[model samples]
Target: MAHRDRISNLPEELLLKILSSLPAKDVAVTMVLSKRWKFLWTLVPRLEYDHSMYQDDVDGSSRFSRFVHSSLLLHEAPFLESLRLKLDHYSCAADIGVWVKTAVKRSVRELDIEINSPSLSTPVLLPWSLYSEGCKRLVTLKLSHTTLVDTSSSSPASFTSLKKLSLVHMKYPSQDLF
Candidate 1:
């Protein structure tokens, strides 16, 4: 008799569940670990990008932009249940908008945007689709170090499936956010 080890033994559903626990960056790295997991990450339902985790984001270089851009490209659409992003620098704002647009089109269940901007003169604008019909499926949202340009046109959005929300250092005028 011969001993055999195969990913098939782990079960497809079980693998997907385990992969879901990892962030988008980790998932991307894990794909190279084994051929079995090449597409395993594709099925994961969560995506997280924290700029703080990157190396030397303080300089506000194009590296941050590339990081955000790469994450969007690596991630699949629609099925993403959560998208947590941290942009600590203004340099990445332009790329952040593009990333948000892609995620919004997918109808993500939760959106966590942390302004990685440490210091800035003027406020940055978030991709203003809150009033658009495309983002109706978005239930939960968090914006830190950011400003909501207009609330009048924005629909009443909440994390329908969202159970908890956290705000770190960003400031907003809305009394409703706690």
Candidate 2:
């Protein structure tokens, strides 16, 4: 009697659904399980990156940033179902912009970004790409501690499919922009 790998034998869709429930970092670790799982994480439609989880590390900020970049770059899902980012003061505006742009490009249906940086004078600015045509598929968008400037006059910041929007401590350039 030998042990059989029944889990691996399951359909890829089922495996992907299982992986989606886990954090992006934990999902990525599944790659080492076996050859069958080497690229499974990349196909998972949901990604959650929480910087607070690595606070105990010596260089957790940089490590977390790198992990986020790598994960987004490697993600192969045709349409991302969700993208959630919980960042701290160490995260830079440039990195945040890039991450949002990547998510928009992936046609992410749900986006939740929260930045905790009370000490900083200025918050990270949301990228113009977020309001562009690429985000037409976005269903839910939640933002916190970020500046939103209506930079895209051409696209007009439309979220046709958006069902829910939550903003917390978000700065806007003008009342007219809303």
- Tell me the tens digit of each residue's lDDT in model 1 across 120-171: 4445556656436667677677777675544454455434344445556664
Please report how far candidate 1 places residue 26 from its true position, in Å: 1.2
Q: State the lDDT of candidate 2 residue by residue for 1-178, as single tens digits.
A: 9999999999999999999998898999999999999999999999999988764348545888888999999999999999999988888778988999999999999999988874444556677778777788999999988887666466577778999999999776674644
Worst 10 residues of 2 by lDDT: 117-126
Best by TM-score: 2
The candidate scoring highest on lDDT is 2
